[model samples]
Target: MEQPTLSRATNPLIDALVLQHLQKRFPQSAECLQRELASRDAAAAAPPPTNRHALLMLLAPPGDETPLWATAYAEVRDWVDGALDTEGARYKPELSRLLWPLFAYTYLELLRAGAREQAGGFFASFHADHALMRRDELNQLSQVSSAEQVDASEFARRLLTSRYEVRLSAFSRALLLGFVAERRLQLTLRMLNERIKLALPETLAPSDGGGPAAVALEDD
Candidate 1:
């Protein structure tokens, strides 16, 4: 077997590219990125699992970001509800599945930032509302007998893109965990979820979940 050599020669360029990509994908994230960097750096020095999850959770919050998260959550729910396939979504199904816990954490983060009472409960209510709205929309469209029914392509585009946006917040968090925390991707996500429960008790609990367990990364 051939040995793989590592190089820091391109590290600077790669870091720049990562920043550029992040900025482009999330224009609003520029403000919080400094904090994100500090967190990432801190996380880099930490041992496995402790700082791992918080770092991943931190990825979604810089510069008032939310759209990507909204899309991603929608997609995740779709998969959960059997509307999409494990293979049909954007990120790897296993990776995506493991990272699902961040959605609740992101909502909790937003709630805490506002200091509204019953924040966790409110966010949970909103999630339920969003789910109902989505179901209703789908059902109404299915019953449309007129030629004025929305185009399938347009419908798909809307669903996929919105779902993509929702999921992006969580995905970025996972990416941060993967690149900075140095944990294997699946373990990183698992760490993120478990950490969320520890870091924000109002947002998540062990029993609040019925999702997939963390899987081993493919290359391992």
Candidate 2:
């Protein structure tokens, strides 16, 4: 079997010898290296990150450069709730699952940005609605009042460092994107784009009008 090329700069003979030794004596190390290489390649092929804040700034009126994040957060929460309430039972449950993550992340972001009072108010306003569903997480997050506290909390670390996965039907996804775009909901758009990994059915067709071929929210 042909060995995979590890690098271009290394001598092939030396590379082959090193790989063979590692594979024989430290098989796990060889496997780890292969996984790392694959991860790097995948990251390289990924698209550039969207500067949602900068885009929001450009869209804002001349005197209002800063986003009213507190207001925007409430708008997104209400819109999502109302939209899902009207959705058919088939898709409503799955779509409604988004609220917990949205609430948690928005709160963390507000705290991270040093908006302690807004974060507290945001928490108070929405905590009851999610209490039954996410009681433990809400409790843990409630204790976090500052950026330092957020960093120190294990729950916050896990939530911030990883993407939450949600499955959505093509129609549901299209509806979400349309509403987000129409409302110019920057915070919601940023959350969907950056933190959520949407899984769509394999049989999705182009004519479905799902914004993108990939199961991701479009930046534009």
Candidate 3:
């Protein structure tokens, strides 16, 4: 694999984050910095983080600059739920499956935007509200309070690297997609595109799941 390069964008957060993020992977990162600095006194190469969490936090969308996280997140949250409520009604139980991933991703978005309180509070309000089978997933997500915690967690890693599979009838999927299309929630759509996969055949998908295995990603 090619070595990853880090950016020195002059953002103060990015500057400070480089060493901490690098040290997580390369324990000798301090020496690495000193050596590099010794040879090239005019410039410094930020050490990249081992995981995406740090980068996501530092590079979170312009939305993070909003004066208040709670207010801004509430708008996004209400918009997501409102869309679901309007478009999801006819799909019955199958459509409801989308909520967990949506809720989970919302918390992540807040966390990525440096809203730890909102992330924790959102998780707290909605975590235990999930169905019995999804308790494990909710628990896994709840462990994540900050980007550092997310970078260190296996489950959180899976949420990014793996897809959340839902066995949905074709019609239900169309309805779900229609709403997402109309609202154009870019972050939500991105999460769904990258983190979600649908098992189209009704016969192949599991009917009930509460374990990590239940929400496990599938390989194509």
Q: Best candidate per lDDT, number?
A: 2
Each prediction's whole-model lDDT (CA): 0.34, 0.57, 0.52
- Which candidate gets the maximum TM-score versus the true structure? 2
Poorest 10 consecutive residues of model 2 by lDDT? 1-10
Stretches of candidate 3 off by over 4 Å are: 1-90, 203-214
lDDT of 1 by residue, 1-220 (tens): 2211111122332334334434544443333333334444453423332343443444433454333334444444443445323332233333343333344334433343553343334344444533432454334333322223323334322332232212223233323432432322232233343333211112111222223232112111
User: How far out, in Å, is residue 89 in model 2?
Assistant: 7.0
Clashing residue pairs in candidate 3 are 133-210
Ranking by lDDT: 2, 3, 1
Give the per-residue lDDT digits (tens) of candidate 2, residues 1-220.
2222322222223323333333543454345433433444554423334444544553443433124655666675566556443323344444565667777878888888877888888888888877875677678988888999999998788778888665555444544543454466666766776777666545532232212332233222
For model 3 the TM-score comes to 0.54
Between candidates 1 and 2, name the one with more favorable TM-score. 2
Tens digits of per-residue lDDT, candidate 3, 1-220, equal 1211221123323433444433443334434443433343244434333445654544344443423433433444454345344333334455556666666666776777677876777777666547465776777787788988877888777676667776655444444443333343445545555667754543423233333323547543
1 or 3, greater by lDDT = 3
Runs in model 2 deviating more than 4 A are: 1-67, 83-90, 201-220
Per-candidate TM-score against the hidden true structure: 0.25, 0.59, 0.54
